[model samples]
Target: MSALLRDVTSAVGDVPALLAIARKAGTDAPQPGQGRTARLWELLASVAAVDVAAARILEPHFDALAILSQAGKGPGHMDGAWGVFAAEGPGSRLQAKAGDAGILLSGSKPWCSLAPQLNRAVITAYAEGGGRAAFAVDLHHPGVTCEEPAWVARGLREIPSGTVHFSDVPAEPVGGENWYFNRPGFAWGGMGVAACWLGGAVGVARDYRESLAAGAEAGREPDQIALAALGETDRILTAALQHLARVAARIDGEAGASASDAVETGRSAWSEALRVRGTAAAAVERVLSLVSLNRGPAPLAFDEPYAKRMADLALYVRQHHGMRDDAQLGKLTLEEECPW
Candidate 1:
């Protein structure tokens, strides 16, 4: 397997291990402790510590295919080195025009993760007529080429998130124009990203907590300052986790009740996604800062995994819109009902 494929494979493999540990330990995790509910959070945090971006990419492919299946689109799943490059950008353009076979995607799709290694990609492209659409395209097609030296970044360089150029590449439509976003799963998918963010924070925090606990034992005295930092982070993480559980419950309860009801309830799920994403981002930033302060520069500078985890979390959080998303969340707040 290619290095990219191995990286993704290793990152995803950690999910089940963490959940198993969490469940067997009887964590009673502050969030819903029952069944898959608590296990979900455990999985995200565990995998993210290993590889943040890989964890971020895991849930989306299946979520994308599941959405399509519900839309009467396809029953196929994207296996191997795959990515969902549905985000539109002007830098590298992707245009889809309908033709004899099905559709043709030409131009470049930028920021496609695992580009060179990707066997397939599910992308969002501008249709020839109007509106945005989603499609499944083969990366190895004669018309497609993954740009060399994919990207430059302070972190996450291993994933190869570069541009994929397509020239008259045959495409298979997954959902109608705008159908990808219109589906309730789109927002639900957005919320899933937050889970990964929170998971990465947990991984970072775990190191700091272990470091502090060890120090406390060796010194035969607790360092109040470091302990305080850990305490604060725990509070923030607990609250962020609880909020995620509520949002997950909302998606599960509504979509499970009736698929048709999903359309009407999607907006609420999206609104919650915005809310939880912002919450998780802020919590992560706060926790990471405190953890670094408590542990100082040694772990970050010397320990490869520790440093990478810190850098990875820092970069991944910046990928999402911060205040802009929060502004949208403010508007959404008017639409939701609260116990207050």
Candidate 2:
């Protein structure tokens, strides 16, 4: 494999190992009060898995390009928001803060997926200029601190939500004011996020199948009813992933761009992506529920990996801002503000 390809595979392999350690670390070690380095690493691992898989499939036709291209929405991109807000000069933006010496920050993201072990973060803040911007901050900066949160939910707690604080920690600018949200192709990452959730669901379904097979020797017969339900769930997830893959392919290929306005093209691409993500999220929920029902009380009797996978899938799927943006879909279709 080429150097880039080798690097991606190595990174992808790190996910399972990191996840194993993070899963065992319990909910308190990465305390909410801790930095999100580890959580950030988990997100990175998740992203790496998908990108590597995509690269393997697409490499036959595309050649040497990085399958997991990092646009503004890529991993570590959120910290870019810090600079966006900071450049805004001053306001109640997501990651920006103002103090006598300069803009100071002391807030936790609470839901950073790979924060527990990440060394850097693209944080957001209000700029001294009175506009929104993002900054890429080195997590090891002395003024920066991490706090892992205590509350663990049904899913994705292995990521360990927490707060990152910056006591006048200096951060460099990543983009101009409001650029983080205004940039083109910002929505692709949303779809990418959903894809990871789908993967976790697939993992659960795989384990569940194995469990069912193991039980058969004890005379457990196949339930035709549950089989159909599981099949349907699988079909939905497959369709969603297929749709997302198509979009990613198009974007990487830059298909349909030469003939159309770039903004319009990107908007359409992302809008369709959001729809697919929502569908995938729903499909995952249904699959999880169906699996639990089929397994009876046995699945819940112990905290099997699938149980944790289900929890992670549940929380991760809902992390996107897709629902609130759905209204824009109608507007896009009508070429005017949505009447609804």
Candidate 3:
């Protein structure tokens, strides 16, 4: 970790060191024909190796920074720590309204990660008439209050997950009415989360790798079934890596092509994100499940890193909506195939 990166990311546990390492390694410009995808994966892999929760906490910041830096549509008030809070559910939640008091946010923002730590957030609140709108709100304002953490899971305790109550907090609109979600980078950001999932899977797999390596050194051959399971896990991960590369290439091509066609660009980015997210989640789930079956509960019971990584990876992959998301991807993919 470099001194500068340490300084920049020190407030967030463990991420500064990983970011410093990535900076030292250097990455190509995020353009087509450049190895920017590899660089992204490189950073993600390093973060996952150290801590999955940290990666989860850090990725949104990376995405938010990229989103704002690439397109400075956000207001100047969002100059501090930022996150994207846009999870709308079938239950009660926040409502964004406009009145004499300026744009106001009321209700609870659920699943607001790093809610206690963030000073600013690029939030999506339900528009008054209909649809969604993104706003840059200051979390430090008196209207905003962090509630008790809502996560009871065994994984990702380091990344706080809870509801943030907004009691008519003032906010500045970001871009067009739906510009934030409409932006191409929205789904690309999802891919970044998948990248973290990929890294966490790799970290968990390291446990088996070391175990196998020790066996190899002793001139011993493991059972053929165990070896076969390992091989299958490797194949799954390899497939996911290739998918990521392809998605990155497509995104790079889009970025280099046009600045006007944001709708098409967003569609393409989301299509790629949904596709790769499905593949990557399945691959990670498979690797963890198979490895757990092959090795039994010994590691989970004894090894701290491996155990945590295993738990973390299991929860992280749930970012994908499973069959529903895959179904959406299939429909979009088939529609794209037709030359209209």
Candidate 4:
């Protein structure tokens, strides 16, 4: 096991320990679109390969820091674990209203993972003027409350995702109306999640290889069926990794250009992010199928680590939105001059 994996595993059930890892990463890890974008993705993938739950906790903290940096702000005095709570759904919507003490947030925000454990978060809410805006809010504010998590999923069980309610909670605006969605960092953050999925698939592939090796050590020569599955997994993972690297390079190149080119950069980055995410999600699904079909249920039933990784990966990749995302990407392709 790698050092990151070991550290994450040791921090699994301890929220403080996990937050320590996230805080350290926020200070040390390279932000997306910096010169070392590939390294950032690699770090995310490495954490996921060890523990998806740990990655789930860490990715958002890194993303929150990136969002701040992109807006020319820094964490400064505000410290500890951070998260991004921007998911919107039907029901009580979070609203940002001008208050005597700056902007205040009210109502409920959905899908806030690890909200109770985080010290702060970058959240999106309906702004007073009409459009959505992003704000950095203290999760520990007296008016803030995280609902009892209703999470029942087996994968990422350690991270509880639920709604957080605010009642005149003070907030500091991060960006202008709709800027959160319009920024290039938005697309880059999605790609980071894809990196975690890729890493989870890598962990599953590693287990499949180990199982095959163990069989061989017991005087059982590997059959062509197992060998074929292994070869296919190798192909899938290699393609995914290469695609991630290529996209990372593109992001860094775009970042080095003039500020006047931000609109074009943002558009290109969004398209590339969609393509890479779709590709990585498909690769992970194929790897899961091949490993499960060839290895059967023995490892899943008896191997604790392998079983947890498979379960975690299965649930985590669903963030890709499958066909809905494909349709969106298809529409994007239709608009491109030469999408092929």
Candidate 5:
């Protein structure tokens, strides 16, 4: 409907199509091949934003959800993948009664990035019956509406983020009142957000490399310096991803056998990932900024992919709640510090 919504839908819609393309591009892909990787990448990319209407609406029926549930399989299935849609953030209110034939949902949600293309949304709402409850409602319902409220930051503007509104929209209960927050991997979902930022860094770095090749005749000394800076940033991001991957594997291993420990480990990993994400983002920004500052006219040019990547990367990576906080990093060391 809205231009932003159309853009997001187009972006998300590309997931299945891209996977198909990837499969065709690579003949040696595993059984289910490109589809699997595409799904994984799509999921991981979803973490780049808090809006994941599709994930929440579709995960229950997809095999990817089960694979993602395996925390031990490594962060590949969960960390960078499995966007946590209904897990956190501001709460909403729901109306459902025994005598009433249909469920009524009325509320507003902020920062629902995937709200546009989400045919259905798994949302948390205050239940008229008692406590909080999780519900799945079709987005196209007569009373349902989504608006791209302003407040979007630079770069990640493509997310199509905005508010979702429901005025007596029909709804069905998905999980229990506490189910959304108490879910095993709830906190870990937060850490996965870092992975998306990491991907953006990778994307930027790749572009930077290409730009360097094209500008070979420009000069060598400054180009070499930029390369070195990018290398360091890559190192930092790699370390962060490695740590996150390890924790994801550990969590999965523990998940089936012990839910409690799995949750704990997941939380720990989530906190650590946040710190790593912050550091990685900072590293990338440092290099990007250095290139622009020292290169002056040459590097500041916007047509190059790497030229404007920093701004987008910075905006995208900066969306994290805890990553924005300096104290959260300390919580990773002291287990008791996690409020949730």
Candidate 6:
């Protein structure tokens, strides 16, 4: 395990400590498609293996840094934890307007995780002209208000995603109109989330393995069902890891390709991200079912870590968007000359 992963593991239950680790890691952690893309994902997975909540906290912080880097900007004098808040939904929308003072943001943004704890964020809002644009804002600004989280989820209980209301908050534009979604890094960041899902499944599989070993040590011979589940989980996780590595290689391979290929490269990345996320999400679901059915309710009823892992993995993977994402992937595949 990497030192960062080790630190994350040791600080699993402490949110403040995990945030501190994330702050420090932003300085050195590798960004996606930066040649060390594979290592970047491996680190994310390792962190998830120890604690999904820790990965939950760290991924966005790292993603925010990657976003800044992609825009030819760095954290510079800014310090402390950072987050990316780009999710859009119904309700009051965040809007950015240019003023005599500067660009100012007002309205509410949903799904702002760690907003209360983060010092800064890269947020998306409707630009003065029309399309959405990305901006960097200081969370400590007087006009910023992080609403009290109403999160009651069992998994990732440590991280409560909440809404933030901005009242004429001063902001600095990060990129041009619609640049947030236009960049290939958008797809790369989605794959990073899938890596975390893969790691959570690995953690659950480890629990199952340890259980089998304990049974064997107590002079109980392994049953066919137990062995079969283990074998199946091994197959599932192995395939997911291989798929992730292949995607990482593709990302690195296209890093500095010709500008003429930029459009095609972005399309390829979007399709690849959809496929890998689907694969990892499916693998996690299958492993969860296999482990639960074979191991029965004993672990869920008794083991705290095992139970938490199950719940956390269950909730975390739901971010993949399931059938909706599959439909988009199917359309993308159909557009290809030879999808097979």
Winner by TM-score:
6
User: lDDT at 287 for candidate 4?
Assistant: 97
Error of 2 at 243 (Å): 0.9
Residues 212-251 of candidate 4 have per-residue lDDT tens digits of: 8998999987899999999999999999999898778767
- Go through the candidates in order and give the C-alpha RMSD of each one to the true structure: 6.5, 9.9, 4.5, 2.4, 8.5, 2.2
Give residue 238's lDDT in candidate 6 (0 to 100): 100
Kindly list the per-residue Cα lDDT of model 6 for residues 1-340, writing each as its tens digit. Answer: 4788779878987999999999888788899978888898998998888888899999999998899888888568347789999998888699999989999999999999989888999999999889999999999999999999899999888888999999999998888998888788989999999999999999999999999999999998789989999999999999999989877876776545454433235567788889989999999999999999998998899999899889988999999899999999999988982237
What's the lDDT for residue 235 in model 4?
Answer: 95
* Candidate number that wins on lDDT, 3 or 4: 4
Runs of candidate 5 with Cα error greater than 4 angstroms are: 1-99, 129-131, 151-154, 217-219, 223-227, 254-301, 322-340
Candidate 5 lDDT score relative to the true structure: 0.49
Give Cα-based local distance difference scores for all models.
Answer: 0.68, 0.49, 0.71, 0.86, 0.49, 0.89
Which ten contiguous residues of candidate 5 have the minimum total lDDT?
26-35
Model 2 vs. true fold: TM: 0.66
How many steric clashes between backbone atoms does each model show? 1, 75, 0, 0, 5, 0
Candidate 5: which pairs clash? 44-80, 44-81, 71-252, 72-252, 72-253
Clashing pairs in 6: none
Q: Which regions in candidate 3 have their CA more than 4 angstroms from the true location?
A: 1-38, 73-78, 218-220, 254-264, 337-340
Q: Per-residue lDDT for 15-131 in model 3, tens only?
A: 444344333332222312233655565566556655677677656665665665545653344255567888876665777888997889898878898777776778888888677
Which scores better on TM-score, 1 or 4?
A: 4
Indicate the residue-level lDDT of 287 in model 3.
88
Tens digits of per-residue lDDT, candidate 1, 102-183, equal 7899888877876555567678899876888888888889998887753667576565567778999998888788887877
TM-score (C-alpha) between model 4 and the true structure: 0.94
Best candidate per lDDT, number? Answer: 6
TM-score of each: 0.82, 0.66, 0.84, 0.94, 0.64, 0.95
lDDT of 2: 0.49
lDDT (Cα, 0-100) at 127 in candidate 5: 72
